[model samples]
Target: SAAELLGDPAAYESMSQAANPYGDGRASHRIAEVLLHHFRGKPRPADWGGHA
Candidate 1:
């Protein structure tokens, strides 16, 4: 299935620049922030740790 999907040249290019359904490539940063908020028991600002 993976090979079939990637084998289509047009499909490959289309998928490359597709908008991320999640929070872009900054998902890890967002996840870390949520963890920190839960552990610290407070609403931390977006800039709490650093830039995403």
Candidate 2:
């Protein structure tokens, strides 16, 4: 759709993709670990940091 909007079929080739700057898409998991329990009554993993 971006390429179509730009009217340049080659535009897609120039697009750049990168990792999510905020986190590794585990925000919901992190929130659940804090506000809710994942496995009903287990402790969170030792390394539960958001991202690198």
Say which candidate scores most in TM-score. Answer: 1
Which tens-of-lDDT digit does each residue in 16-45 have in candidate 1?
A: 767765535676777788888889876874
**Model 1 residue 30 CA deviation in Å:** 7.9
Best by the lDDT measure: 1
**After superposition on all CA atoms, how large is the RMSD of candidate 2?**
4.8
- In order, candidate lDDTs are 0.69, 0.60
Residue 28 Cα positional deviation in candidate 2, in Å, after optimal superposition:
1.7
- Looking at model 1, which ten-residue stretch has the lowest summed lDDT? 43-52
Task: Write model 2 residue lDDT over 1-52, tens digit each, in one string.
Answer: 7647478646644543444566667767667776545657667545664453
Q: For each candidate, what TM-score against the reference?
A: 0.38, 0.36
Error of 1 at 7 (Å): 1.2
Superposed Cα deviation of residue 28, candidate 1 (Å): 4.9
- Worst 10-residue stretch by lDDT in candidate 2? 11-20
Residue 51 in candidate 2, Cα distance off native in Å: 2.8
RMSD of each: 6.2, 4.8
> Which pairs, if any, clash in model 2?
none
